[model samples]
Each structure stands twice: as structure tokens, then as C-alpha cells.
Target chain A: MADVPTKTARAEWGTRFGFLMAMIGAMVGAGNIWRFPYVMGNNGGGAFVLAFLVLLFLLAVPGLMAEVALGRYTNKGVIGAFRDVVGRGGMVGLGVVVLLVNIALMSYYSPVIAWTLYYAVHSLLFTFTQPGFEAEPFMLGLFDNAALMIGLHTVVMGSIAAILALGIRRGVERIVVYAVPALVIALAVMTIRGLTLDGASEGIAFAFTIDWAFLTYSDTWIAALGQALFSTGLGWGIALTVGSYLREYDDVPLGGGVFTAIGESSIGILAALAIFPIVFAVGIEPDAGAGLAFVSLVEVFPEIPLGGLVAILFFVGFFLATFTSGLLITEVSVTTLAEETRFTRTQTVLGVCGGIWLLGLPSAYSVDILDYLDFVFGNWGLPLATLMIIGIIGWVMGPERLRLLAVNQNAGIHVGRWWNPVIKYVIPTVMLFIMAYFAWENFGTAEMIGGMLVLVLFPIIGYALMSVIEGRGEQPDTADLTGGDD
Target chain B: MALTAEVIGMLAFTLLAFWGIATWSLVRTLRQEDRKVEILKHQDRMDTYSPESLAELREWIENNPNDPLADEARQQHNECVDALKHTDMHYYDWSSEEIDRLDRV
Candidate 1:
């Protein structure tokens, strides 16, 4: 591997607050607000929450920490960091996997951010709050309108590109420093308002009440684990890219990884508080599935006092969370290009965002495309990639060495030897089982095959071709084990 | 299990406490960062020397190698040079071929 630079000029978090906020902002996306509530509600509420917490601590946090450590220790993006950690050559394939997952995620995710932005504007305009409002038709019309979808998508992607072009501290940190606090306060206010509604308590009961029956079902555990992983942005290389910018003194174990996980998981609960009470108060179903936020909330908003304003605030918060998360995901791709290829940050942003915008066209045009991409990447691609990452860290790099070199090195809360076994054995085993179950359930579908071929196989082949084209050359000396001062 | 008055009260309290802690933590960290920013600004001034000034300092250190301030000035000059080199290195990008070659070693 190329030697670690004796000095680095990479951008860093300006403050601990900025770093933590960015991390939380990256983790607590619209998924936490929408997906988590319905999933928790569907999977026995408190029981699922319990499983999710356990998995977050046991599997997700360690995976996140390992990624962060890889990024910080190597001071490289996913591809470069992988090469640094596990020598070079074919490790490029692993990098490709990480890069492709983020890119694929961004393709579908950005459009959703656009949708949130659209809904936020729509709420402000009182489009849906008008008398004789029909939410289904309104949503259908919005989704079917390719021009509007693409316009909003362009706007969202363009804004992200603009922000990223300003560099890390000036752009990402500054935005998240304001956006995350705003998101939290908005959710808090919404929760307070929602709680004041009649019958709101029923929703809270539904959310927190445990149905022990779900504990017997393996699917519940798997779903909870998946939620935790996706919710915390594990296996996505975002944390890894974010970690690449960490100053030497930034704590990884406690403040960086653990605290972010805690903060993110709390947002899920907070979202449930903000959402469920309003849903029950308006007599809408808590397990309204994916439509809980978009449809159900739209239906209920007009019934409540000052619902129009509340709707605007909620969607604005949703947009901010998703936009920030999208920014981080896009950064992974941007950083890779800027570091690995002959692209400056500005050129990389243009190339990456333009590419994602084009790729997201089909998703913008059709719900099927979006769902297909989400199913493939979110369900299969992410889990598989995450498993591969942990396996690399645990087996290839030696979990104990990673612990000493990455986790415990400059961390305030030193990870113990227990981390080694948990990462090396327990996490991988759980991940493997989840992947297997998902594959078994999803394998025969045409969408699965097409997605695997397009998303998974195509990337691997492209990387192989690139590697061959590049050819092997003289190797640089091994990086100095002593990480240089920033 | 029902959402009684106490349950509602507990939920509200918990969320309030979470918001409180998050706000407090953010405020504390931002305050600490303000102080760090002041120190960093000063350090930025000390660390940054113009290339012409650095060249002169280098010449001065070479001429007065044994002078009391020679060691300190030389160290500062070297640090500035290193920082410039680091910045230049970051500005340039590596090709896939170069990255592969680096990985091989």
C-alpha cells in the first residue's frame, strides 16, 4: 500500500459539534421519520424496538466504528481506504462494491428527497389542504408527472452539488450545524402539538406496547436488524468517507460512533412521537406502511389545528434530514473520484451529481423503478456489502489489530477485547443469516435477478475491466504505521 | 400498556430530556469550538509564512546556524514547507493505475 502521508491537507470537522451533527444528520434521514415508525408498528412495536436497539449496539455500531476507523486511519475514501487496509490489486473490487452501493442508493434516494421538498412546498401552498382534497390522486399525479419529478430531483441534486463544492467545513458542517438542530426542534414541536390532540395517546400505546409473539418470529429480528443497519447508514461507506475527514483527536468509539448511533435511534423514537400521535388522533392507522408519512399524514394534517403550518414544518424537517443524508452519500462518490481519479472537487461534484441525476430519471418517472432500486440496493446490496466490509475488517485485517490500531488508538472510550469477537464472529454470523434469509425470500423474482445483474454484476465487471486496462505497476512502500499529525 | 395520562407524561418528559441533552451538548461543543477557533486563527498566522519570507528565513538560518533563534526559525521554515507540500499533494489526484500501483506495495 502507498505510504500514509506524513502530513495531510484534507478538510476536517471545524468543531466537535459540527462533526457530531453531521454524523447524526447523515444517520437520521427520512427513513427514520417514515420507515422506522411503520416497521416498528408492524413488527410488534416495543418488541421490535428492543431488538433494533440490541442489534444497533451489537452489530451496527461495531460495523460503523470499523468503517470510521478505516477512513480515519487511512485518511482515504472507501477505495483508497480499502487498499490501505487490505493491500491493493483486487481490493479495488471491494471498493467498487462500496462505491456502487452508495451510487445506487443515491440514485433512488435523491428523488425521495425531492419528493419531500415538493411536499414541503405543496404544504406551504396549501395545495393538499384545500377543500375536496384527494391525497391519493394528488400523490398519483405528482408521481406520474415526470417533468415535476425531474425538476425537483435536479433542484435537490444541484443544491447538494453546490454545497459540496464549498468544501467540507464551509459547506457540510455549516449546513448540518444549522439543519440538524432545526430538524430536532421541528420534530419536538410537532410531537408536542401531536400529543395535544384527542386520541393521540392511543398511538403512543400502539408504539410502545410490546407484543411478545413477534419475538418468536425470525423475520422480526431480521427486519429489526436491517432497520438498524439502514437507519444508521451502516455498510454504506458514508461513515467511512465522513471518518476520512476526522481530525486526529476526534474520538471514534464513544462520541463518534456510539453517540451518533444513540442519537440516530432516538430520532426514530422522536419521529414515532411526532407521527403516530397525529395519525391516531386523526383515526388513521399506525401501520399505514410506507404511506404513513406521505399519505396518512396528508390525510390527517387538515383535520388538526394549524395543521397546514405543522405539515409545512414536518415536510421541511423531512427535506432537511434527507437532503443532508443524500449529501453525505453523494460525498462518498465525490471523494472517491477526487481521490482516485483526475477530478477536482468541483469537477467531481458535477460529474457525480449529473450522473446520479441521469441515473435517477427512471426512478423519477416510475414508482416501480424506485421500488425496484430500493428493494435491490436497500434490501440486498447494502446487506451484502456490509457483510463483506465486516468480514474484511474482522478476518482480513484481524479484528484485534483493527481494535488496537483504529478503535482504541485515539478513542476516549476504548473498545475492549470483547469487540474483537463481536465483530469477528457475532456480527458476521448475524449478517450472513440476514443476507441468506433475504436472498431466499427474494431470489426467484425477476426484479431481483435484473437488479443483481445491473447493480451488482455490472459494477464488478466494470471494475475488473478498469483494473485490466490500468494494469499493475511498481508498488509504493508500505504506509508508516505511525499515523502522521494533521 | 394503555396510553394513560402517566404514559403520556412519561413520553413527553423523555422526549424533552432528550432535546435538553442534545441542546446542551451542542451548546457546550460550540462554545469549546469558539475557543479552539481563536487558537487556530493564531496558529494559522504563525504557521503561514510567505514563500519569499520563508526563503529569507532559510538563508538567515544557514548563515547563523549556531544562533539562538536559528533552530526555531529552521523548524518553522521546515514545517511551512511540509504544509505546502501536503497541500500540493492533496490538490493533485491519483489515477486508477497509480492507485493500483500504490496498492501493490
Candidate 2:
């Protein structure tokens, strides 16, 4: 209501394939390429995959269906979508909570993407295969060099800003359609290369051997749960933002929910195939974890056949993975801000990208700062955002209404009553449990305190801001839209 | 360590289940979109809801006449019914009898 501009016609994906690719491109980031492969290797491999797959279908699929359906139904960005559902009040601030979390996440995330970009460029230079290339010094050289990290972070954000400035179809879709498939091909080639290496079969055995006993471990399920949700980027307002641009008659459940979730995870499976064999082949620690493994795994690339080329493929593909996610994560803010305020898309893109780059400077300056922020936000902020999104759908907007109206309207598959409770009950419960678990695990720590701060403050800020804003005159009458079957 | 048959079998199943299902979903949804485009090109409008979904819409509208979104729901339900009745070919499975039986909710 405060000096809002007349709205422009919304953009739609130029093609269905573009939409699907965007979802996959956004979801399959460093998590899929780096973390997923090793997480699978360490977590009883086949048993973990089974549990992860089950959780993906059970939670991620339905949660995404609801989120995307809300977006398409309202045809608006996060806050605007919230305004439509919750009406004109401080309550609309709940959407603000989502926006804040997304921005915070993207801030630290830009620096990480910068790491991938640096590695990708190095890969192209055949740096990893250089006889004198020392993995620790190379990685440390990049991490410790504040100027280089900042420059890379600036480049990543600038690239993202430039891409997002082109709008959904021309900018986002155009890039993703190419970037996603390229990542797959790179991984596929690496997989084949890894397989032909001496002792590569040991890698497969390590990754594929079923430890059925893992199914009985609570830790295994927890690990699987995190992998499933994190890899899919569920409830991150990402699916919602992407879903907002869905063309009329686009099916939400099949494309947005099923394909997006599974397709992204497929890349993880491919990554497991791509990386594990090589790690085992060269005798690196399989459980070195994502960060250590990433640095340690680099030395192995040169030790293998076609090592230089494989290095290029892995890093460049890794760059694209993180780059695409940076694009969409930034888009969540651009899309929402463009609609909520008077800013044009280009203006919004610059403002958002500039803000993120500025905030990311600290993280880029120090690896420890980046890790600290990552731990705090990744554990808490993401789930809180998820809870807000799915909570609104389940409680306020009503999953039954959403399924009946938007989800099933052009759904490729029928979503029955079974989907309703999952959206309403199961997801919120899981989110609460995640937060509680993290809080307990990190008790008395700075990370836990930072998380606790985000949990408490973000909603209050959102609510207070909305209350003041909505108190202004000449707002849209959203009364009828507020309550549903729930 | 040599790859045992158990490891080999598990690898195959994981690939088929994850990559196979993903590939299948991708093909199916893209195909569905193509079919929707084809049908839309032939007619001014295509049916928005599948038969099963349309019926659910009808049932929901009937049950929640006073619901805030009921009017929109009814309108959507009827739009599908109209498209199914008017279009020569349909995207979702619909029998001749079913089309004949369909009316505005």
C-alpha cells in the first residue's frame, strides 16, 4: 500500500523443459555434487539410499506439491503469496520471515559458489593435474587469499545478477536448461572414467554394498532425512518462486514435486557413482566429509587416467551446480521484492545481488566465518522457512483446498487425501523436530545461539514490518481469501 | 575388494530406481506438456482438470458451497466440463459417456 507501482504482467517459463530444468538446476547444487556422494558413501550406502528415497517421496514430494500449488494458485512471489493467503496484516509478515531467511542463506551461499567458481576456473587451467599441484596449499591458497575469494564471490553474484536481470524465461530458464544437462554429462563421463581405473570396483563395493543393519539405526534415518530435504531444497521458497512462473495448465505434482525432487537426487546418485570409485581407487578417506573430501579428493583426480580433463569436468560442472542455485536463490528475493515494492526487476536484481555480495564479504574474507554462518543458518533458518511455507498451506490456506484447486487441476497424477495430512501434519512435525534436534545437538554453542536468535527475531521483524506497512491506506481486500477448509 | 553380485545388484537397482524413475518422470511430464500444447493449438482452450480431478472439484464445490473459493472452484470445474464437451480430442482420459454425462457444476 506504500507507494506500490502498478504490477507488470507476470513472466512464465518459455518451455516445460525449462521449468523442469530450473527446478533441478536450482536444487542440485554443491549439496548434490559434493555432499551427497560422500554422505551416501559414509552412511551405509544402499541402506541410506533406500531411506533417503523413501523420505523424498513421503515428505519432499508432497511438501513441494503444496508449496508450488500455492505459488501457481496465487501467481505471486513469497510475500505477495502470503498476503493473498493470510490477508493484509502483520500476519503477512510470515512471508517476510521466508524472504529474510532466503536472503541470509544466499549471502553465505554466494561465497561458497565463489569457491566452486575458483575451482572450476582452476580445473580449466589444468591446475589440479599439474605435477607440482599440492591440494592443501592450492585449496588453502584460495581460501586464505581474501582478495581472490572476494573477487570470485563478486563474479558469482555479478553473474547471477546479470542472469536474473534477464527475467525468468530469458535469464533463468535459458541458463538452467543448458547448465543442468551439462552437469549430468560431466558427472556421467567422470563415472565412466572412474569405473575403468584400477581398483575402481572397490569404490562401487564401498558405495553399493548394503548394510541392511543401517536401516535400524536412528542416525541413518536422520542422515537420510537431512539428505533428502536438503538436497531437494524443499520449503525454501524456491519451489514457490519457480512455481509462480509456471504456465497455465502446468502440472505441479509431477514436474515440480516428483521430477524436481527425484531428478536432483539422481544427480547425487550420479555424483556418488562419479566420485566414490575415484576416491576409493586412489585410496582417499571415504568419510573425510564434504569439505575435507573436496580438498582431499582433488589430488586423486590427477592420479587417475584423463585426470586433467576429469578435473575440468568435475569442477566446471560443480560450478554450474552452485551457480544455478545462486541464480534461483537470488531470484526468490528479486521476484518477491519486485512485486511487493515499486522496484523494477533489474533494479531489484541489482539491489538484492549487491546486498548479498556486501554481506558475503565477511564470509569470503574468512573460511571460518563462512563455516560458522553456514552451520547456524543451514541448521535453523532453512527449516524455519519450510515450516512457515508448509504451515501456511496446511493450517491457514488448507492443503485440502490447495489439492482440490491447484495441485489436482492439471496434475499429471492424482493426489489423494493422503497428501493432505502429510502437508499439514507430517512436514511441520519434522521441521519442529529438526529445529529441536539441532538446538539440542549444538547446545550452549555460538551456532546454537545464532540459530536461536534467527528463530525468535525473524518472525517478529516480519510481523512488525508488515503491521506498519499494512496499516497504510488503500490495500487490496483479501478477507475472502484468508480462510479455507482448514 | 572385488564387486560382489550383491553390490552389483544393489547398484543396478539404485540406478533404475533413482535415475530410471527420474528419467521416466521427465519424459512423461514433458510429453504431457507437448500433448497439452497440441490440444491447445487445436482449440481455444484445453481441459484444465483431469476426469478424476474434475470430479473431486465437483464434490468439493458441492460440499463447500459457502467456502471462499467455491465460486472459483465451480468455475474451474465447469471450464473442464466445457472443454471436454467442446474439444474434439482431450488431454485426460474421458469416455464418450462421461463427456455426455458432464455438465456445469
Candidate 3:
């Protein structure tokens, strides 16, 4: 007499626009504006971009479609969805990824948000004039004290948790409705202005110039694939968990891809606009692993016109992006706690937020610690998680069942029965190839080794805990946890 | 003091490198052990019933009503039969992709 868990809240989007905007909020974040262009420049600019786009089609979009299908059909978070598709093992694997990735991101991401708030307030207070005079003073104004930035980060994290506590369609969705469009317009304006500068052509050229030789390298391809998965927030289970809330009628896969595409492409383009002009103008070498976003950009900020104002605005945008993502991650943790502990939703939310805040203290205290954590969880944890998710959905659950769940909610475009077979056998094989390729190029390095540990550690720990909790009873038969009706 | 600091840093780096390799080996070993346990569980379950019991089991299954665990039981039954060499498990190989072939048959 095992009972099916009753659906608590039907995660309905207020409108199609709201859903799209929220997806955009989730997809577009710190990585896009900060990391994309610099990485592209260092990695051979247009050539890398082209390769990344190819990987998106061959890997990311299909992978995303699969995740969205799992969410919409099951109407459950990562843990629940995996249990339905594969088994208890799958659930533990996904839970590990989601928890670790969220923890790693929150560690360093909050500090950047604080910096944004600091600059935004400073801009309004007349610390930076529009005429670009007193540039040195503006640059000096920021980072003169680390204490102020840390305080701002704490405040921002609290606000983020509060927004999530308000639930998806009401608070988080509403903010994105306005914020995403504003972000896009701001990025476009900045790009145009950057191109018009005397040294702007050099920047644009630097971004657009293709190095054909680098295209053949396996490392380049791996990096591109990783970015595609990371940028869209896949495998980490945030997107899938959000997708679980949707009504059955929505075109979940299409919606996910559209958001991912826009988010990923905009990041690549916007980072170019912010960085290329300055880097080329200043004669700094563009190297992919040189930590372009924070270190490189801040060094050049003092030279730009109304630099403080721009800095503030840029940080605001950065914070908005990361804040939206942080909010969603917190929601996942809270919801999981509520379901597992039989705690009320409010109690779970409060407890989870407090816990994440406490865990994130080490990261907030030092850049080196934050960087190491990010390297461990963000880089390696996500890809490993994606690989396990693909295996569960594409192999264990049987492709036909997965495909049926995918097509049940909305059936406009017909992919036919071949879809499941491809997902089952073909997709996982491709992911394996990609993962192996990554390991060949990057494994054995200290950073990657730390990353592999973080990725594998929690799943083992989580499964051990579950064995303790539900070990002897006729365990929750993972096979019986099927996705919802079409 | 500076010389001492450099020596300490090198030693820490070496220790970290050693730890990484050890962890990787441990993960690989644990995964192998888990797979072994899963196989053993399946074997023990299969060993619980004989051919006569399986035939009677099949008859009982045919008569019994469908429930959430019905599909699993059937799959496990097939696995058992395959293990006992009573029959091949290819009967369940009919993927949805083979639906057209199934229809033709």
C-alpha cells in the first residue's frame, strides 16, 4: 500500500511571458557577462563561439529537452524525478549534484552581488559623474574596503531567500518579467556604445577574429560542451526542478531551449562588448584561463568614461543575474527539506537558507577558498551530474516511457518513436565521450582532482544516509515511481 | 622564515596530490563493490524459487490483478527464467521502436 505523493502546488506560470522571463533569469547570469567574451577571446574568439553553438545543437538543447520532459511529466524536483525515471540510486546522484553545485555557486556568487549593490548605491550618490572625469577616484572608491562588500552580500542573500519564500509565479517570476528585458536592453546599449569608441573596432575584431587552428583541439570542444551544459543550468537540477512546477499543457522543451539559447548567446555577445574594447585597447593578452571577469575587467574599469557609474550598473546587472539563480537554488533545497523532513514549507525555507548562509561563510571570507570551491563543484560536479542524469533517463527508465512523458503534455511537433531510442543509446554514449574527453585534457590537475571529489563525495554520503533511514523496509521501489499521465 | 614557508608549501602540494589519487582509487573500488552487491541480490532473489514454482508463479501472475509492482515482478520473473536457462529474456526486447515490426508480425 505504497501511496503516491500528492501534488502540493500546481506550478502554473502566470503567463507564457512570465515563464519565458523566469527561464531567461535562470539561464542568463554572472557567467554570461563576465566570463563568456574573455574566454572566447582567449580561446580563439569566433572559432570558439562557432564550436560552442555547434555543441549547443548536438548536446545542450537535446539534453535540456530531456530534463524538461522529466520535470513536466513527473512534476517533481530532481530527487523525485530521478527516482521515478531510474531508481533510488538516480535520485541520490541528482541530489548530490544539485546540493553541491548550489553550495559552490552561493559561496563566491554572493560577494559579486554585494559589489554590485555597493557600486549601484555609489552611482546614485554622485560618486561617479557621467562626463568620465575623476576616473581614478571612482576606481579607488570600490575595493578600498572588503568589509563593506561582505555586508552587502549578506543583505543580498537574505533578500534573495525572501523572494523565493514568496514562491515562483508571484515574487521571482514578477521580478524577472521586468528585470530580463531591462538587462537585454542595457547589454545591447552597452555593446553599441563600446563599438563606437575609438578603440572599439579593435575590441569587436578581437571578439570576431577566428583562430582556425584551435578548432581541432579536444580541450576547446570540452570547454564548449561544459559551458553549454553549465550556461543553461542543466544537470544541476535547478532547471528540471523548476520545470516540474509547470502545467501539463506547456511546451516545456521548446520553452527551455529558447531561454537557454537567448541566455547563452547574449552572455557571449555582452561579455565581448564589455571586455574586448578594453583588452584590445590596453594591449593585454586574452587568455581563456586567466580569470577574465573579475580580475581583468576591474583593472581596466578606471580608464573608461564615467567608470564608476558603469561599474555600478554592471555590478547591478551581475547581481541581478546571480540573485535570480541563487533564489531558485535556495527554493530547491527548501522544498527537498520540506518533503523529506515533514517540515512545513516555511520552516524548511528558513532552515535551508540559514544553513546555506552558514556553509557559505568560508567562501565569503576569502577569494582563494571561494575559487577552489567553485572549481571543485561548478566545473566538475555539473558535468558528472549531467552524465548520471542521462544514464538514468536514457538507459534505466527505457526511452519509450521517457518519450511518452515528454510528448504527453504538448504534442504539436512529432518526433516519432525514434526519439527515445536515440536518447537511450545515443545521448548517453555522446555524454560519455565528452566526459572522457574532459578527463583526458584536464584530469590529474590538482583543481580537477578536488572537483571530482566534490562531485562523487556527496552522492556516496547521501546514499549511505538513505540506507540508514529506509534500509530494512520494503524500500521505495524506484521502478514503480513513474512520471505522471500525459 | 621565507625559505621555511616555501618548503612547507611544496610539502602541502605533494600531500594534496597524493590524496587526490587515493580518493580516485577509493571511488573506483566502492563503485565496483556496489555493483557486486546488486548482482548478488538479484541472484539470491532468483535462487528463492524453482522451475515448478516459477511455472506456478507464472500461472499465479496471469491470474493476479495488475498493481504498481506487477511490471517489476514480471521483469524480475523474466530475469529469473533467463538465469535458470528455462527461457531467453528476448521476449521483453520489443522496444517501442519495434512497434512497426510488431504490428507487421
Tens digits of lDDT, candidate 2, B1-105: 678888999999999999899999999999998898888888888778877788888988998898888888888888888888888988888899989998997
lDDT (10s digit) by residue, model 2, range A160-277: 9999999899999999999999999999999999998888898898888899999999899998999888888999999999999998889999999988988899998998888888
Docking class of 2: high
- Return the top candidate by DockQ: 2
> What is candidate 3's lDDT per residue for A153-225, written digit by digit as tens?
6787788777766767787788888877667666566555555556665666666566778799876776676
lDDT of 1 by residue, A176-268 (tens): 999988998899899999989898878888776677799889889978888888888876788888888887545676555676776887888
The pairs that clash in candidate 1 are A1-B105
Q: Candidate 1: global Cα-lDDT?
A: 0.74
Best by TM-score: 2
Q: For each candidate, how many residue pairs have backbone atoms clashing (under 3 Å)?
A: 1, 0, 1
Error of 3 at B48 (Å): 46
Give the 10-residue window scoring lowest on summed lDDT in candidate 1 chain A.
A477-486
